[model samples]
Target: MMSSPPAASPQALLRRLLSGVARVFVVPVSADGQLLLHRHESDRHCYWTYPTMQRGTMRTDPATVARRLLREELGAESGVLRLVHVLPAARTHARSAVYAASLDLPAAEILAAREATGTSRRALQGLAVTAETLVALDVRPLAINDLMTTGGIPARTLLALPDLADPASTVNQPG
Candidate 1:
């Protein structure tokens, strides 16, 4: 059999494949000013991450990735998600899409949905912290403005927060 093409040098391979890598982060914010965070059992008591999505080549579709992340981590779907920002991840070429969804939905409803769908309820075990607690917890603050300037967010789309008020009632009440 003919031999495969000669192996490419690490630099050459990296140069050729550099255009394909990216990182997407989702940030959820509640109207009460509490920030939704994911707490891993690792050394860091808590940090911010959207969901467990493939980091490299698997991150091809941003919208699909965003929708999947909300469902997997927050147990909520995209019908009411608010796009907040898209920011770059430090110095890496990767970027992140930040989103904010209110905790208007009752915890009980959230629980029932997760159970009924056979989804992992343990993903968001961390306590939802207000903006103040986030500082104390040493978690990095992600902002809507930062994501907009990094070329991470879609240029044509203006990220806006949805008025997720209950349709049944004119007044927005706690769900």
Candidate 2:
């Protein structure tokens, strides 16, 4: 068998890889200002995340990755994916680009592969969470201009959503 490259070769390559863009975060935003997220826990308290996917190769385009994720993970065929911004992630210690897509309507079934994301389409299976409910996650303040630019959404959207400030309020809702 042929010998593999030196261990230092892999290490050096990783350094170069991490130095640049490493992952893509796809955010689906509804016209009413809600966002698509995933969860694993079925209880009142659960962690959430965007449908994030890794770049297969450095030369791969971010939009391609985002589209692939929507098609593969959620089985969404059509949507206009827009490049939003590149942001740093303290949790992963890597920089990631964020892409947003406008949703005409909610999908009948979301999160096609629960095994992939570790979320069970639980009680609040609705990935389309409102602005008020989003901020409650504490990942970042969704009410701020950042994170899908919540500040730019119409006031009527918020008025249309139920009072989900209380996590328990969603307990009775479907996943």
Candidate 3:
């Protein structure tokens, strides 16, 4: 029998567990509660997604992650953030906490902030368009991979069957 390699040390195991297990999604919304999605391009396809950042040294503080994402991505100070949903791994992503940030600033101001931070490359949507329009435009990005992967449907227009299980949840489910 071959000898087994050394087992992973507790420190290494803990490190692995702590790392790559958490990420945060910041969904900046207008005062009227419209989702502000940014353009995201992946190998699979281009889709709209909320600004996301990995959980850093402050592993337990998701709020910190949200604030940092807002500052870095939009170059704005923290807004009134409230937890909206917790999504387990969808596709290769780790667990994610979704926070809705209520921003009082105008879309032009937000765009300026992104430009000021030298992040003009990012395509931030103006407030006039709602998530409805994005979905209607036949663009469903990777964030909803778990659902799309299951049905092999890439867009809302193709999804015709309604789930009787939770009719309430299906209202906006592009899955």
RMSD list, candidates in order = 12.8, 14.5, 11.1
TM-score of 2: 0.56
Question: Which model scores highest in TM-score?
Answer: 3
lDDT of each: 0.47, 0.51, 0.57
Query: Between prediction 2 and prediction 3, which has the larger TM-score?
Result: 3
Better of 1 and 3 by TM-score: 3
Residue 45 local lDDT, model 2: 59
> Which digits, one per residue and each the tens of the lDDT, describe model 2 over residues 1-175?
9998766554464344345677877666543445556555655756666677888566776677888877665556434555545666566535776666555555444433434554433322344444454555544323222443254342223222332122133221112
* lDDT for each residue of candidate 3 in 49-164, tens digit (9 for 90 to 100): 66788785564767677887887777766445655445667665677765656676766777766777786467877533433444455333345433323333223321322322
Give a tens-digit lDDT track for model 1, residues 1-175: 9989999775564334333436555555443333445555567564544443444567365445666776786677543454344455565335554544445554456556776886775555334443344434544433432332333221212233332222132323232
Give the C-alpha miss distance for residue 121 in model 3, angstroms.
4.2
Clashes of 2: 5
The best candidate in terms of lDDT: 3
Q: Which pairs of residues collide in candidate 1?
A: 86-147
Q: If scored against the real structure, what TM-score would every candidate get?
A: 0.51, 0.56, 0.57
